[model samples]
Target chain A: MVSLRTKGSFLKLYSWLPILILYISVLNEFDFNYLNLEYFSFNFPFILIFFFTLKDFKHFDYILVFIAGLFNDTVVGLPLGISSLSYILICTATAYLRNITIRPNPVKDWFYFLFIISLINSLNYTILTLFFSFDLILMSYLVNTFFTFSFYIIFVSLFKYYLKGLND
Target chain B: MASSRDDFIIAIRSAFLKKSTQQKFSLLTLVFFSLFIIILSSLDFKVIRYSKAVINELVYRSSFIVSVPENFIKDSFIQVKDYTNFFNKYKKNISELESLKSNYVSNEITEYENRELKELINDYVSSSNKILAKIIVDHDSPFLKSIIINKGSKDNIKIGTNIYDQSYLVGRVIELNYKTSRVLLLSDLNSNVPVTIAPQNIQAIVTGSGVDSGKIKYIKSGLSGQLIDDSIVYTSGTGAIFKSGVPIGKLKFFEENSTNEYKVEFYSDFSQLKYVFAEIITQTSILPTTQESNENSVEKNNPLDAKLKILEDELNIIEESNKKFQKENENLKSEINNLNYKVLNLNNKISSQNKTIDQFNLDTDELKFLRLNLTYGHKCRKSLFNNKGFIVGSAGYKDCVLRKGKIDG
Candidate 1:
C-alpha cells in the first residue's frame, strides 16, 4: 500500500512536467544562448505550448501558459503581454488545427508547425517594430523561426515518449 | 461551398471558445486579456506602474533563483576557457598594466582639470557615488542586448543611471523597479550615444549594430575621410544624457563596397559582465546665499589650492627628471676624467721608453768605440804617427769609431 501511494505521487509529478518545464524555460531562457553563436536562438516555450495544446494535455493550463508569457517578457525585456498574445495565438492555431483534423499525421503536423511559427514570428516582428518601436533585426527573427521549426520534430519525438510512458 | 464555410466557422469558434476540463480560461479570453495587459503596460498610469513594479520585483527575483544552475554551468565553461588562456592573458595584462601605470599620473591631472572645467561650465558641483551592483540576469538575448542588475529605485538608481564595468561605460539603466533595473547595453539596436572621436575631435553619434560593436553615424560629409582607425571614442555629454569624456570604445574603420565603414568596438565586453558599478550622482548648486557664502568661500579656495597643488606636482616631476639628468652627467664626467688620466700616464711611459732607447743607442756606440780602439784606435789616436787620424776625445773620433775607424770630416 505504501509503495502504491509513492508511485501515484511520482506519476502526478511526471504528468505535470510539461507545465513545470514551460515555467522553467521562460524563467531561465534555456535557449543555448551561452554558445555565443550569432543569430542562433529558438523559442522553446512556443514549441512546448503548440505541441501540448494540440494534444490537449490535461495539466497544460492556458492560464499558466499566459503567465509564462509574462515571465518571458520580464526575462527578455520586451513589452508586457506581447509574448502572452503570441502564446495564446499559438494555442488557438494548434486548437483550430486539432479540431479540423480527422486523422493525425506527424509530417503534416510538422509542416503546419513551420507555417504557424513563421506566421507568428512575422506578427511578432511587425508588432515589436510597429507598436513598441523596438529596434529588432528581421534576420534574427527569421533565423529564430527557422531553427525552432527545424527542432520541433526532435522535441516532438521526446514529448511522444513522455506521453507514452504516462499512458502505460 | 456553404457547408465548407460553415465547417470553418465551427472550427474557429471551437478553437477560440472551448476550454479543456482542467483549463481555467478559454483561448479567446486569454487573448483579450493579453491585449489588455499590453495596452495597460504602455500607459503611464500610477497604479499600473506600481503593480508592474511589484510584478517585476517578484519576477526578477524568481528569474535569478531559477537561473542559478545554468549560471553555474556557464561560469564553469568560462572558467575552463579562461584557464586555457590564462598565461597569455597574464602576459598581455602585465604589458597593459605597465602602460597604464605610466599614464596614471597624467590621467589624474587631466581628470582634475576636467572636473574644474565642468564646474566652471555648469556652475554646480556634482559628486558621484558609484555603487557596486551584481548582475542578476545576463542572458545575452539576441533581440535586445540587456542585463538586469540587483539595484533599483530603492538604491537611488534612476532611469538613466550610467552603468559601468570598472571605469569604462557599459550602458544606461532603462527600466527601474524597487530592487532591480534593466541596463540596456551599448550593443543593443536601440542604444545611441553622442561621442567625440579623439585626436580628430570630430563629433558624431554612435548607434549599436545589434551586435558586439557600434556604428558611427551623423558625421559631416567629407569629415569621414579624416577618421583614422584605432582612434578613441568617448562620450560628448551633449544632450546631457551621459557624462562627458567617459571612455566608451575604439573606432575601427573598414572599407566595404568602396564605402568607408566605421565601427566602435566597446572596451568592455557586455557578455562577460558579472558585476557592474552604477553611478548615483548628487549635484549641489553653487549659487551662494548668506548661509552658503562660507561654503562658497571654501569651495573657491579649494580650486586655487588644487591648482597650486597640481603646479607643485608638476614642479616636483620636473625636478626629479632634472636630478636624474644631473646624476648621469656627473657619472659621465668622472668617466671622462679617468680616461684623461690614463692617457697622460701612457704618454709619460712612452717618453720614458724613448729616452731609454736613446741611452741604449749611446751605450752601443761607446762599446763599439772601445772595441775599435783596441784595433783601429791606435792609428786614430792624438799621439799616433798617422796625420789622418781624429783626436781621441773628439766628436769626430766617436763618429770614426761608429764608422769603423774610417776618419772622414
Candidate 2:
C-alpha cells in the first residue's frame, strides 16, 4: 500500500522504460564508442533525452545532466563529464524550448522536442568529442538519432491508444 | 440513454467539482510519463533491471503461449530425424551381427561383447573447489552476448570467474546477483582470451566479435606458411585466463590480404548450453604480456553508449551518401525516408545495447586502445604533415585508422 503521491512518483520512474529501451537498443548497435558513430555509442541527443528522462529530472536538470554525463565521462575513459556538460546544455535548452513553445498539439510538441533534442545532442557530443578528437562516422549518428527519435515518437503514440481506452 | 441537457448539467458540475474524471486521467497519464522520465534520468540501472525482469516475465509468458505450435512442429521434425538415424544404425548393426553369426566359430560375438575393454581408473578424490549453476534465461536478444545463470554471489559466483561446459571453456562470469549470475559468453564483444597460437610460440588475442564466429587477431599474419584456411586452432590460454591446450574455435574463412583478421568459427555452442561451472578466481594469470594494467582499466560503460553510437553512424551514412545531390533535386524529397522512419527503432536498439553492456558490465582495453590509436594517428598525421611538408591544409582528409591497435609511446 502506497500513497497516490508515492505511486505517482513511482509511475514517473516507469516512463524510463521507453527511454532505457531506446538507450540499450542504440548501445547494442554502436557499442561503448565515440569514434564509431554506430548504434552502441552514446551520441549527443541520446544523452540529452536520456538525462531529461531520468527520475527527479524536473529539478536541477543541469545537475542531472552532469551527473549522467559522469557515467559516460568516467567510461568515455578520459577527462570525464564532457558529455555530461554537453548533455546538460541540451536538456537546459529543451526546458527553455518547452516553456517558449505554447502550441497545444502533442504530436507537434513531440516533433519539436525531437528536433531540438537531436540538434543539441549532436552539437554537445561533437563538442566534447573534440577534446579527444577521434573521427567518427558523424553521418551515422545523425541518421541513427533521426530514426531513433521517430521510433520513440511512434512508440510513444502507441501508448496513447491504451491511455485513450483507459480514460474512457 | 441520457439527454443532452442532463449531460450538460453533469459536465458543468464535474468541471466545478474538486476533480473531474478527465482531469484525473490526464494527471495519471502525466504522472506515468513523469515517473518514466525520472526513472530514466536516475541512471541507477538496478531499478531498470528489476523492471526488465517484470517485462521478461511478460515476454516469457507470452512466448511460452505462442511457442506451443513451434515446439510441436520442431518436436515432430526431430522425431522424424531420430527415426531415420535409428533405422540406418539398426540396419548396419543387424547386418554386422548376421555376418558374425555365420563367420564365428564356437561362440558368436554379441554386439556389446565385441568391443574395446573398459579400462578402469581409480577415483582418488581430494580437496575440491567448484561452483554449480544453471542457465535460467537465455538472452532474449541476439549478439551471442551473455547468458543469465541461476547462480550468483550466494553461490560464490564473482566477476571474472571462468565458466565451462564439462571440458571446454564457455565464458567468464561478468555480473552476479544473489541467486543469479550472468555469464559473459566467450562470443560476447567484451570477451577476450589470451591464447598461445600453438606450434609457433605466437601469442595473440582471441575475441568474440559476433555470433557463430570469433576473431583471432594481433598475430603476425604470414610469418611462415599461414594461409586463409588452416586446421587446428587450439587455445594456448597463455595468460591463465583459461586452461592450457583447450579448443576455442576452428580456423574458418581467412582474409588473405588483411593482417587484421583470422576468422574462426566458435566451437563452444551457446545454443546447446544449459548448465555451467564457474571458476571463482578473479584474475587469470594467463597472457601477462598484453593484459591491461589495473590502473588504466576503464569502468564498465552503459550499453546505451554503444547503441547511440550505432544510430549516429546510420545517420552519418545517409547524410554523407545522400547529401550533395539531394538538395539540388529537392521538393523536400526526404531522399532516404527509411532513415527518418528508423528513429525510434534505432533508439530502441541503442537502449538495448546499453542494457546488454550494463548486464555484462562491458569494458574493453582493446577497444579503448583502438580508439586511442585513432587519436594518435591523427596526431601523428598532424606531426607528419607539419614536419614532412606534405602541405598543411590538404592533410585534413588524410583518413587514417590505426593498424594493429598498437598503443603509441
Candidate 3:
C-alpha cells in the first residue's frame, strides 16, 4: 500500500540489501568470522554489487545504503558502524558505474553488490580477530561465514520480489 | 518545484536532529539485556548446584518454567556424581564389614549367647507371664513423640501397656490398631506419671513437654533451692500406670521463680531411641469406695489429732517460757508508764520556767517606767518650781499635762 518514487524505491531496496544479508546469515549462526568458509565467499559479493549498481547519487540513496550496512552490523554483531560507511561508498561507486555503462542483468549487477561488500566484511573480521587474539576453533569461523551468506541469499531473494514490485 | 526542493533539503538537514529508530530499538535492547542479567544472577545457579538444603522452586512463573529444564539438566549431571559417591561409600562399607566379619568370632558367640539368653528369658517369662518382641525401625515417628510397634491389639498389646527398651522402661502403648500400635513416649505432652526416684526417694510428677524431653513440674515452690545435678527420676506409679523404679531422666537443672513452679531439664536422650519393648502389666486394682472413704477419714482424723497434740504441747512449752516473757513484758510496761510520768513532770517544769520568764519581763517593764517618770519629774521641778514665782501652779499644770500625755499614749 505504500508507494515510492522510482529512484527512491530503488535506493530504499539497495540500502536494505545488507540487512537482508545479515539476517539470513546471522540467524542461522551468529559467528562473525570471515575466512571460516570457502563456499560462502561465492555469494557474498552479490548483495554488495546490488548497492553499487544504483542509478543515481541522491543523498537519500547513500543514506539508505549506510543504514542497511549498519543494520547488518547490528544483526550480525560485526564491528560497530564501519560497514554502513563502506556501504555508502559502494553505493556512490555503483551510481558512477550506472552513469558510465549499460544497465546489466539484475542478477549480475546485484552480484557485484554482494561480492564487494562481503569482501569488505571479510577483511574487517580478519582485522578485528587479529587484534582480539582469542583462540577460535576453525569450524566456528566456517559456520559464521556460511550463515552470513545463506542469510543474505534468502532475504535478498525476498527483497528481489519487492524490487520487482517497485519497478512495475 | 524549487520550493519543494528547498523544503526537501531542509528535511534532509534536520533528519539527524530527530531521534533515530536505532536509538529507540537500542534502548529496548538494553532494557532486555539488563533483565536477562538480573534473572541469571538472582537465580544463583551455583548455590543451587552446591547446596544440600531443599531448593525453593517457585520464585516466579518464568523461574518455575526455567527450573524445569534446568533441573532436568542438573539432575543428569548430579546423578553421575551421586552414583560415584555411592560406589565409594559402598566399597568402604563392604571393606569395613568384611574386616569386622573376619575377626568377630564374638558375633557367633553373641548369637549363641543370644539364643541362650532368649531361652533364659523364655524360662523367666513363662514363670513371670510376659511377651517379648523385636523393635521395628520403620515404626518411628518424626512428628509425634511416639512410635508404632509390630504388636498391637492382635498381640494383646492393649492401652496402658508399658513399653520399655533393652534395659529401661520407655513409655506406654496409648493407641493401638489390629496389626500396628502407637506407643506414646513418656516425653509426650499428654503423658504424666508420678515418679519416685531411688537413692533419695524423691517423688515428682513427670510429664512430657510435647517435645523430646520429659519435664518434672509442680516442684514445691516455697522450697529453698532447686534440683541438684545427677538426681535420678523414677516412676512413682501413683496412677498405677508405670511400674515403680522405671528410670525416666536425671535432673539437669530446675528453673524456679516466685511462683514456686520450676522446669526440670531432662538428661534422657530421646532422639536416638533404637530398641524398645513393651510390658503388658495387669490392670491395677482400684481401691473400693468404702475403703477409699475409710482411708480418707483416717487421713483427716489423724492429721487433726496430730495437730491437736502438737498444739497442746506447744501450749505447755509456751507456759514454761511464759515465766520469762511475763516478767519481761511487765517490766517493759512499767518502764513505759514511768517514762510517761517523767515526760509529764518535765512539761510542768517547762511551764514554771515560762512563768518565771514572764515575771522577769514584768520587772523589766516596771524599771523602765520608773526611770521615764523620775526623769520627767526632775525636768518639771527644775524648769517650773525653781524658775517661776508661781511654782506650785506651773508644776501642777506640767504634772497634769504629763499625766494626760501618759494616759493618751
DockQ values per model: 0.74, 0.01, 0.01
- Which digits, one per residue and each the tens of the lDDT, describe model 2 over residues A66-147? 4444433322222333444445444444444444445646666566656765776576446535644433444545665665
Taking all chains together, the TM-score of candidate 2 against the true structure is: 0.40
lDDT of 1 by residue, B146-215 (tens): 9999999999999999999999999999998999999999999999999999999999999999878999
B42: Cα error in model 1, Å:
1.0
> Per-residue error at B206 for model 3, in Å?
1.1
Q: What C-alpha lDDT, on a 0 to 100 scale, does residue A34 get in candidate 1?
A: 54
Tens digits of per-residue lDDT for model 1, A3-59: 999999999999999999999889898756556788899889888999999999999
Q: Would candidate 2 be rated incorrect, acceptable, medium or high by CAPRI criteria?
A: incorrect
Predicted structure 3, TM vs. truth: 0.27
Q: Which stretches of model 1 miss by more than 4 angstroms?
A: B287-409
Model 3, stretches more than 4 Å misplaced? Answer: A1-168, B1-130, B134-143, B224-226, B254-268, B282-409
Per model, the share of native interface contacts recovered reads 0.78, 0.00, 0.00
Clashes of 2: 92
The model with the greatest DockQ is: 1
lDDT of 2 by residue, B250-364 (tens): 6666556674346767666665566877766432222212333231133115435434544576679869878766765674556566667788699999999999887664456
Top candidate, metric TM-score: 1
Candidate 1: residue B140 lDDT (0-100) = 61
